[model samples]
Target: MTQSTTRTSSVPPLPPPKERRRLREAKAMTEKQVAEALGVTQTTVRSWETGRTSPQGRRREAYARLLETYAAELDEKKHAKRKRRSKNPENAATARPAPETEAASTAAPTPSRKKPLNRRPVRTVQADSRSRQNAQRRKEKAAALAGAAAAEAAKLTPAQAFDELYAYASPALVRQTYLLTGRRTLAQESVERAFHLAWHRWPEVAVDRDPAGWVRGAAYDYATSPWHRFRRAHRHPDPPNGERAGRALRKALLDLPPVYRRTLLLYDGLGLDLPETAAETEATTPAAANRLLHAREAVAERLPDLSDAHVLHERLRELTETVSAPAVASAPAVRVSSERRAKFWTRAAIAVTVLIIGATAFTVVTAPRQYEPTPAPGQRVGGVPAPMGPQKLSRQDLKLRAKLRDVPMNGPERLVPRIP
Candidate 1:
């Protein structure tokens, strides 16, 4: 008997492995289930999904068909769900409402309902009141402690005060100076100079209302002075590393004008108050406030994420900590000896006296000389006899006088003849 001949066509190309995996996951089918259906190990199916090894021959055809079927099934399920929701709108709405109400009721007890329970007992209420009063008493005790600390601080010797301030303030000043100057050595030098000044004036500085502010102001001045510029010109330092966040922040900060940069760093970066920042920058409080606002806008324009005060402050803190100078355990005292101070005053007084004497000498030498004018023949003198009414004229004098008398009167009257 002759059997009917049948032809089998080749399977089309399967979707990419990633696409296959996505389709399988969409239908919530595990690799094991797909593997069991395909009569293969789950590891084989995993390889196929991960694109490590693809199925070959008829297996490839079966895999493609499986993914397609599952994707279609997922779509059908979603469509069926939507259709049911549309057909029984009231039933679906009522079904959701009960669960939502249950959830809300459950969550409400966690916060508001439980709060009333804690508040229900009179004893608890009394305890809370007592706790608040205790907190107030603690605050008063803290204030007293602070006052005693201030008194103790006031009693510290100049050297002790200097050491304390140097330890506490040097790091912050160095960081602030670096931001202002953008040079490590220059920043260090500026801080050193500032502290030196503080050391010399510690007697006064220790008693000042805001010694830190004074030091900060001095550091700023030192950072911005012409001497620093000259030094910077002579020695050009390399920029910060490109990989660090501080590089971008430092560049943005340096782009700002000195006034705005100092105002911003002092106010936000160093945590100085508005008035203190103003004093540091030599600006009025309102002017400093305006500068801070403008500076924030300027920095935000450059680095948008660092616009918030808190964010910028944190960023600056991080950058500063990265480049801060080591704490100085001891610094040389700048206080002049009493003899030296006396000599300085003596020299100053001598200089002043010399200046006064030189000025008097100069005046006497350069002044104009006074001379008395000789009286004319018939003119009167203030302290002398009036010339005798013209002496009798000799013939020769008479002739010369007659010759001069005939000459025209060359005066204002002659130049501008009187109107007739």
Candidate 2:
């Protein structure tokens, strides 16, 4: 066998993690701008700066090259400042050049000066302090501009924004729903339905101050709906498992009324403030606080270990996070489904309207136009009796007739007689 030599590409070295941020800021570049240049997400760039992750392969090379360019520009700016400083006669006379070590660190940036015109040491110190303050203000202004630019660059269309929101919120929402409903399938359906509704009502949802909260409310409502009990699929409760505390906690949550459970989850599990929880639950703050109290009492009754609010929050969050979430359909699919459902309901409504119109038209064609009243029911009365068959004589009438036949006819009875 013959040995063969091969050449490989080497990735360039990156600056220290802390220095990465300094370099980018010093260069007056936004994370968005750097991300676009490197063909990555701004989050990835942030991760690189934060030392959570490092770039690799061509990306590593690209990042290193970009940082190097920023370094070069900073060096150029430093040189330009030196040239300006040297050209000023007053500063050049007294001020010596900055040592290499003093010029190296960029953590604190100070204005370059050749000399002080006053030559008063105390005034020079005061002036330098003012310059440092000015430099800090400049840094803050630059950072603000960078943030605004990033936000502008990240502007997304409605569909794109919805998709992003769905991606960010759905998985966690499913888990939350699971904790609420205790059923994997129900949780999955609830989350998907909520998103579908959100997409259908995108105009309302997109402009909402808390779009996630809006969707969350819808999901929680659906997950805890009493109507779900009528469905064969959701008639039964999901079996609880895991540690004693977790199962007991889930059972306690399920046992509580939907409103109380929701309040507790919002306040404890999700960490919403009382006012926010109340707003999301559509209840007054006091009502929400009361519900939270009752819910906590119920849970504490079962498991004394969770009597403390912090302990309950920890257990609830852990249980929700540990449960596996069902995979949700893509945002596009959800929007399409919502459109289909809306169209179906609309067509059904039109059909019903047409049927009603037809019924009215039939009534108009066949209904009697003349004035007619309902006939009074036949009734026997003293003035005008209904014609009925002759009734049989009673025993008393027969006896009276027999007595009349046996005795001589007496004076005509002073009574009214029937006319023939």
Candidate 3:
């Protein structure tokens, strides 16, 4: 018979006993299972089992528990090996005592000393300083922002405060105005005028629950003013029949029978919800308001498309830019001529008084002289006789009278002043 040959596969290296035990325990799996899972030979698994090398890092955890289990099995196998050796008396006797040399007798070679640990104190300090600097910069920036915000808030006046509130409501106002007027110019003018009205009554307006509602009301009234419509109707005067279209637009407005244009402007523009709109428009309710709104819509639809917002914005921005700041507070007041006024009235009064006095004095002077008439000589002597030389008619006067008898009465009439 041929001699049979048996060959054992070589095992891979592993770390010391403690590491092997930890590796097996950490894996929480058996050695055979771990070897099969890793696609390794059983000899390789046993190598890890015998403590010649260790799995590094993350891989160590995967196999720690598994290898530990394998290590326990190895321990049992080692015990069996010792037992067998002890029981085989002939084989044990062959384990003869060794002759001890000094070098051999010396304690088993001590393990190499481990390197000292390196502490990174400078790196730790640098990281701490960087963190503190970042925190300080953030604090300073936050403080500056807070200060700016506070200053801005402090600078706002009551009028500006109200303007901001109105601005918040401007989008709604724009929509409302566009729908109602069908002309951007009209809408913008109406809004500005309305704001002016609101400013005039701001003391009362600001206290209201909704100041925007008041503004809308004012805008409606402004837009629908007969004067406004008339001006728009006659806006163009130079071109041939230029004023006709304007007249027609005005006629349409004036022809609108019952509903006030104000109610229509608010209902159509601003999108004031029914009840609120009614309150602003002074309508009875949503139903009544709708009637006015519908009426305005019918008329507005016939007009040109004048609701381009971009155009409106440009126009408005231009208007704002063109408008000069009022110098009311800074400008000198108009110097009315008080002295001129006073002098005029004074002269008039004096003239009237003098005329009245002259009329009265004339009447007084002329009244007394009228009562006494000169008495004639032959008349009853209620008055003194005329002067003697004039009492009797002279001979020459008689001769003249005889000659006058023949003459015509009108040719030479005698002057008779003697009778009163």
Clashing residue pairs, backbone N/CA/C < 3 A, model 1 = none
Kindly provide the TM-score of model 1 when superposed on the true structure, using C-alpha atoms.
0.47
RMSD to the true structure for each prediction, in A, is 34.5, 20.1, 43.7
lDDT of every predicted structure (CA atoms): 0.71, 0.79, 0.51
- TM-scores of the candidates in the order shown: 0.47, 0.55, 0.29
* Better TM-score candidate (2, 3): 2
Work out how many backbone clashes candidate 3 has. 18
Model 3 ranges off by over 4 Å: 1-156, 171-175, 182-186, 229-269, 286-420
Report the lDDT tens digits of candidate 1 across residue range 197-230.
6765666566555677777777888787765445
Ranking by TM-score: 2, 1, 3
lDDT of 2 by residue, 212-311 (tens): 8878988998898899999998987766544464676788888988889889888899888886776567554578889999999999998899999889
lDDT of candidate 3 over 144-200, digit per residue (tens): 997996688568765675657566655556445533444556666666656655555
List, in order, the clash count of every candidate structure: 0, 2, 18
Whole-model alpha-carbon lDDT for candidate 3: 0.51
Indicate the TM-score of model 3: 0.29
